[model samples]
Target: MAAIELRNIVKVFSDKRRGRDLLTLDNINLDIEANDFVCLLGPSGCGKSTLLNIIAGFEQATSGRTLVDGKQVERPGSDRGVVFQQPTLMPWLTAIDNIAFHLKLKGVAKAERYDRAMESIDLVGLRGFEHHHPSEMSGGMNQRVGIARALLMNPSVILMDEPFAALDAQTKLEMQEELVAIWQKRRSTIVFVTHSVDEALVLGNKIVVMTKRPGRIREAVNFDLPRPRDITSPEFNDAKRHILSLIREESTRLAQAS
Candidate 1:
């Protein structure tokens, strides 16, 4: 059964200055199966992030419906955990405290929160740096804290919006492997948004490609590549070629329209 579903979703923004209505997403429909790793891939301004936001209940769609676990998504909850592009941890809090912030909000005791948060810290390989503040950590470490914080919620669905886009290439690769390991062990539903085709192929079991602004689904491709995917392999290149062709064609079509 589908863990998350978006049916005939539409989002429109009023351009008050231009005295017109701008359509951002049009009739988006998607079904994300339980424990599936899906990626929303497209060029910038394609509403990929907007779709993620809608699923997270951070924004409302102008029309249609979003359902998670057979219930309507009216607002954000602990059941849906979001890791934004930026690591928005509280600078005042240490790594363990930041990971436990949600638990604290629910009035969990400090000792209990710390204990629970510590488990996640170790899961993300941050055991040695539990007391470090955001300022003292590197960008990658801070992002790890963000992931740990989200995992502490034990949410059924994890939403990531280009969470590693800001890191260096080596760091991004390391994080991707670590994330895959975590997902394999936990088996939670993940909907990740990224502009990179390679990243999508590496991380997603299913990839949904979107068109340029006034975005719509171009296609949904399923992949069953072996774990610890070799980027240099022929099968990997074949998938990459197919997706690259789709993106290139879309870009050309948009160029001609303009």
Candidate 2:
């Protein structure tokens, strides 16, 4: 069964200032398989993140429907976890505490919350820094905390909107590797939004490229490249070339329309 199903999704935003409705996603239909690492890749403003938000129930589609685990998505639930572009962790709370805050809200005991949070902390490689607050840690570290927090929920689907976009190149690479490892171990469905082709290539088994503006799935390419993919390899280069061609074609079409 599909982990996520988006059927004929149409999202229109009311542009009050412009006195018009802007359609952001047009008739988007997609099915993400269970435990699939799918990357929604496109240029900025292509509505990749918007589509992810719709799936996460942060935004409602103007038309059509979304289903996860065979049930329609009506609102945000614990079954789907989201990691935004920013960490969004509590500034005053320590890393472990921030990760465990959800459990605390659920009335889980102190010892239980700590125990649960520790598993996630260790998963994200933040064992020694568990007591550090968000303000005290680097952007990458805090983002790790955000990811850990999401993992602790054990959600069937995890939505990440450019979660590593803000980190340094080295940190971004490290995080990508770590995320792939985590996914392999945990095996949950992940829908990641990003405009970076290299990032998509490095992380996703299925790459769904979107067109500009009113985003449409241009193509869904499946690449089962082995772990620790060599960016310089012929097969990797071939896949990258194909994706770049698609984006370039879209750019030309958009330019002509404008």
Candidate 3:
């Protein structure tokens, strides 16, 4: 059985100002198997984030159903961890404390919480900086804290919404490598949402492309390229070319409609 399933899902948003409803996602059907790294790739405003939110139970679908681990998703739980675009950490809390916040909420003792959080802290390579507050860290460092916090949950699936979009190119590449390493060791299912084709290609084992507004699945491509993928390789270029063509066609259609 798939670790996560979205069966004929549809999401409609009420546009109060326009006095009409807007369909954000339409007839979306997806099945994510265990330990698979899936990236939702599309143009901005294509409802990629919305779909992730639905799976995370932060939002409800207008129709159809969402299931995680064979159970319907009704609300957010520790079984599924989410990392947003922003770090969203408490400004006053130190890195270790921020990572341990979830454990604290569950009424776990302070000593145990700190101990468990330390593992994730080291995993993300923020050992010596654990005592630093968010205000004292770089954007990339704070984002690490966010990822570490999620990792400490030991969730079956991790949902990310453009978590590295704010980082510089070099930092982004480093984080991608670290994320890949972590996934390799932990073998957790990851549903990552990003607008960048290159980002999706670098991180995901499978890429699901979506169409513009009122999003629908355009294609689900399986990538079997060897790890530490060389972006300039012939196979990589071929896959990129195919995906680019699909995205170009979608953009042209949207442009003409407008």
Candidate 4:
């Protein structure tokens, strides 16, 4: 069975001032297979994040259906984990503590929580800094903690919304490499949302490009480029050029409509 299935999904929001409802997602349908790293890439305001949120069960669609693991998604559940653009860790909690907070909330024994948290900490390459608080760490380190926290849940799916967007260029590259490695090792289904063409190409095995609001699927480009991909290589540039052309065409269409 598909890991996730979205059939004819639609989302609408009320515009009180205008006295009209605005459609955000329009008849969207997608099937994400297990262990697939899919990136939703598009221009700003394309409702990519909204689509991710619906799948995460943070929001419900106005029409159609969403299923994860062949089960209907009603509300937020432990089966899925989310990592946001900012590392929303508690400032006072140590890295290990922050990663294990969910377990603690569930009344897990301290020893077991620490043990599990340690594994994720090492997974994100923050073993030695486990005792450091969020304030003591760099932006990248805090984001690593966030990723570890989510991974520690062992959720079937991980939803990331531009998690590395706030980091410096070098740090972003490092996090991206580490994230891909973790995904390879963990082999969990991931739906990542991003605006960068290169970022989408570098990370996703499948890139789902969306049209501007009211968002619609433009294409689902399969990208199986080898890891540690040579960005300057012809194959890489060729893929980038293809996506660029798609974006350009989308822009031209919108321009003409306006």
Candidate 5:
């Protein structure tokens, strides 16, 4: 069985000011296998993050069921770790403390919590900086801390919602490389949401494309171009062209429909 199963998932939101309910995600279905790095790729407002949240148990689907590890997702649990767009680390706590906070809340001894958090810090390449507070870190460094915190959970799946979106271009590239390395080492299942086609291509072994608003899956493309892919290679460009053509075709269809 797949590690995560999303069966005919649908999500709708009530818009009080608009006086009408908004249909956000429509008939989304996906199966994520163990250790698979899947990227949900689409344009803005495509409900990618909402879908991620449903799998994370941060939101319930209006219809259909979401199963993780053969159990239905009812609410946010430690089985899934989520890293948001912004690093939501505590200001008062140092990096290590923030990463171990969940353990602390669970009544773990301080030494044990710190020891566990150290593994996560090492994973994200935040060793010496572990003692520094979030405010003392750069945007990329803080984001690393967020990822470390999520990894410290040792959850069944790690869901990231554009976690590297806010970083500078250089930092983003570095973080992307580090993330792929970490994923390779840990072999953890990841569901990452992003609007950038390039980002998806760089990180995911499978890219699931979504349509415009009232998002539906356009296609799930398997990409096995090998690690450390050469972005400028013809094969890479070929895949990019194909993916872009699909997006354009979808956009044209939507335009004509409206």
Candidate 6:
């Protein structure tokens, strides 16, 4: 069975003032196999995050099923870890504490919690900053903590919504590299939401493109480029060109319609 399954998923939001329901996701059907790093890429307002939220069980869909591990997802569960655009760490807690907070909640002993959390800390390359508060850490470091927190959970799937969007270009690139390394090491199924074509091309082995609002899947491109991909290589540029053409064509069609 697919690790994650979206069957005819649909979402509608009520615009109370406008007094009409706004269709946000028309019918999104997708299947993400285990250990797959899938990127949901599209223009802004294309329901990429909305669809991701549905899978995360943070929002209920108007119709259809969201399943993970062959079971229907009804509510947020620890089985799926989420990393938001912001780290969303506690401003006061140290990095180690924040990463192991869930364990603390489960009544795990302090020593054990720290031990488990440290493994994640190492996994995300945040070892020396264990006691640093979110405020003391750089944006990239905080993001690493967020990723560590998620990994500490040993979740079956990791859902990220533009998690690297806030960092500077250099930091963003570094974080992307670390993420791919972590994913390879852990073999976790990941569903990432983003609007940047470059980010998607750089990170995903499977890129799923969506059309504008009331989103629909445009295509699910399989990318098998070798590891440590060269962004300037012919193969990489060829794939980039293909994806760009698809987006441009869609944009042109939409513009003409408007």
Candidate 4 lowest-lDDT run of ten: 76-85
Q: Estimate, for each residue in 1-258, the C-alpha lDDT of model 5 and write its tens digit.
A: 999999999899999998999999999889999999999999999999999999988899999999999999999999899998999999999999999988998999999999889988988888999899999999999999999998889999999999999999999999999999999999999999999999999999999999999999999999998989889988888889989998999999999999
Candidate 1 C-alpha lDDT tens digits along 1-258: 599999999999899999999899999999999999999999899999999999999999999999999999999999999998999999999999999999999999999999889899999999999999999999999999999999999999999999999999999999999999999999999999999999999999999999988999999999889999999999999989999998999999989999
| Model 3 regions lying over 4 Å from their true place | 256-258
The digit string of per-residue lDDT tens for model 6 on 1-258 reads 999999999899999998999899998889999999999999889999999899889999999999999999999988999999999998989999999989988999999999989899988888899999999999899999999998898899999999999999999999999999989888999999999999999999999999997799999999989889899999999999999999999999999999
Q: lDDT of all predictions, in order shown?
A: 0.95, 0.95, 0.95, 0.94, 0.94, 0.94
lDDT for each residue of candidate 4 in 66-89, tens digit (9 for 90 to 100): 999999999998789999889999
Worst 10 residues of 1 by lDDT: 239-248
Model 2: lDDT equals 0.95
TM-scores, all candidates, are 0.98, 0.98, 0.98, 0.97, 0.98, 0.98
lDDT of 3 by residue, 79-192 (tens): 999998999999989999999998989999999999899999999999999999999999999999999999998999999999999999999999999999999999999999
Task: Quantify how close model 4 is to the true structure by its C-alpha RMSD in Å.
Answer: 1.1
Deviating ranges (above 4 Å) for candidate 6: none
How far is 55's C-alpha from truth in model 1 (Å)? 0.5
The TM-score of predicted model 1 comes to 0.98
